[model samples]
Target: MKKIKLGNSGLEVGEISLGCMRISNLHKKDAGYVIENAMESGIDLFDHADIYGGGKSEEVFADAIDMSTSIREKMVLQTKCGIRDGFFDFSKEHILASVDGSLKRLHTDYIDILLLHRPDALVEPAEVAEAFTKLKASGKVRYFGVSNQNPMQIELLKKHLKEDLIVNQMQFSLMHTPMIDAGLNVNMQHDAAVVRDINTIEYARLNDMTVQAWSPFQYGMISGPFVGNEKFPNVNTKLQEIATKKGVTDSAIAIAWILRHPAKIQPIVGTMNPQRLTDIVKASDVELTRQEWYELYLAAGNELP
Candidate 1:
């Protein structure tokens, strides 16, 4: 599999990463198969969040892998903190305790990367900085980042942070093209010109932060997958067309579309099916031409001004 540096952190990770949110419901045997297949398929980075299945995902992951140090050494484990019951928390206390919980559950000494799961409006950047400093000093976290944050929110955190924020996880896919739309429709009167993410994509590119695309196949948050959905017949048709031409699954075409961007986005796919995971990893080998890329974008019902 192709490897890319994760933003400016100088950490090399697989082009595609496995999102472990849904593993909480899998039997240990099934989870083991998924993990083994992902590693064998050349996926070395695994993404997790403390809120996933109320932390059961991490616990199950630990059980599946038996928390082997040798096995852990081979993979990059990234998890998020700051989200809590019914609200968000970024206080130094919460961050520190959350990391401790994650480490204990994941059966690891330190997290390769710790991201603030979401923007907490009441966040005190100083407290966050303190939390990160302590974590680093204690060898609990190697890198820091945020998820679902806009450029300004990131700037606010960076103001007090001593370490570079190397990643910003966001919901992005062929069907959800608002980030690309605003850029293409700059200064236009079209609806697509509405900027939602405050040019986060450009900010990450400018600041050398890697943008990790989550839900790469979904059209909207909580809105099921776009592939094979009758509501998105055109996109499904094009996905199939390209998948047939490339001799790969349509899922690979969807993932390849995300990886084709010049921004070098790392898509976090959450499929628990071992075969589906392997098929999705084929994206590393499939390169979409510029024309093909745009064709797929338009197939998702986007218009270029």
Candidate 2:
């Protein structure tokens, strides 16, 4: 597996990470299988969210893994907070409380990275900064970041934050390309030209914030993945075509497409099956040419200006 630094944070992580959302569905024994496979596959980063599986995912992870001091030193654990039972909360109290909950559940004294899961419309940057300051001072969190946030939101928080927001988690895939769409459609008259999220990917690149692409295989928010969905015939066909040439599964090709970007985006895949995790890790070995990268993008029904 290939390793890349998360911006200039000087923290090194695998090119591909394992998202632990669905692993919550696995039994303790089964979850152990997934964790073992992930380590063997060189996926040292395990991404989680407090709200995922009602926080059962983190609890299960702590319970399933060996958790020896030696093993714990080799793993990087990242989790997100801020979304509550109904509304989003980034208040100082909420942020502190959320990190405590995550640390308790993960059985770790410190979190490698903590992200605000989603932007809280009522966010007070000062309050968030206060929370971060306390957490960092207490040695509860070593790094900080944001998820599903635009450039302006990041700047607002960064203005008050002493810690560098080294990572931004956003949904991007061959199927979900809004982050890429706006940039390519600049100066065009198409619907794709309609700006959304203010092209946050470019901001991350400019600011030295690593972009972590979640749902790397999903079609979109509500709809399921496009792998076998008849609604997206072209993309599935193209994935298989490239997978055949590379001698890997179509899913690996899908992930390879995300890793092919110049931004060095890390694709967070949420596959629970042990063998599936192994296959996805192989994407680190598959390289896509520029032509092939755009081919998969267009195959997903995105139009260029």
Candidate 3:
């Protein structure tokens, strides 16, 4: 369980954070076992969203943990809001209400961090800033951030925010290379030069905002995990080769690849299986070489111009 400072907040957290979206579906006993395993494996940060399982995930998580001050103080709890039924809302009223609901559901007096789930097209920066000011002053949340937002969107929010945005949770993996493609193919007439994310990777690094890589093993947004998927035989072969050489699972290699980036991105793994979670955590010990890292990248169907 390697640890790193989250952005410039100086909050030390596990390199591998646990994503709690799927935990709601597990039985109470099973969820407890999973959480216990994660803690034992050195995972200290837990990622959650208000809409995850319609808030049932937070309920199950609270039920699983003791929520005592002693136990709560040892873990970093981060959850998202602003996402509602089929829409996004960042109004001051919605943000304040969402944090209250999250606090009640998670049985916590204060959240380590609260993030706006996704960018709301109808966002009001002042309202969000007001909500954050009130939450911070009341000790409801210690830090703030955003998810799935580009650099400019974050800039807009930062304009009115008194607190520094510490994180930008984004979908990034070996198979998902849009964040890097534009940079690699800069000033070229290639498809990889599209600049889909508006140079989010560089922007985040420049701003000292930690980029949390969600779905580190998934290919497309909803295309599922690519570790052993038949659709990506090349990637699977390369992963297995490296895993065998490193004496780890292919999943560990995939996670290690993400950690190998210079940006110091934290990967949020969403596995609820105890054995799988333990295996994935091995990534904290594995560091890929330059050649091996690029091999895995090219095998994922990415090309260099």
Give candidate 2's root-mean-square deviation (CA, Å): 0.9
lDDT of 1 by residue, 73-135 (tens): 999999999888889999999999899999999999999999999899999999999999999
TM-score of each: 0.99, 0.98, 0.99
State the displacement of the C-alpha of residue 158, model 3, in Å, after optimal TM-score superposition.
0.8
Worst lDDT 10-window in candidate 1: 219-228
* Clashing pairs in model 2, backbone N/Cα/C closer than 3 A: none
lDDT (10s digit) by residue, model 3, range 63-151: 98867788898899999998899899999999999999999999998999999998999999999999999999999999999999999
- lDDT of each structure? 0.93, 0.91, 0.93
Which residue runs does candidate 1 get wrong by more than 4 Å?
none
RMSD (Cα, Å) for all candidates, in order, is 0.8, 0.9, 0.7
Rate residue 84 of model 1 by lDDT.
87
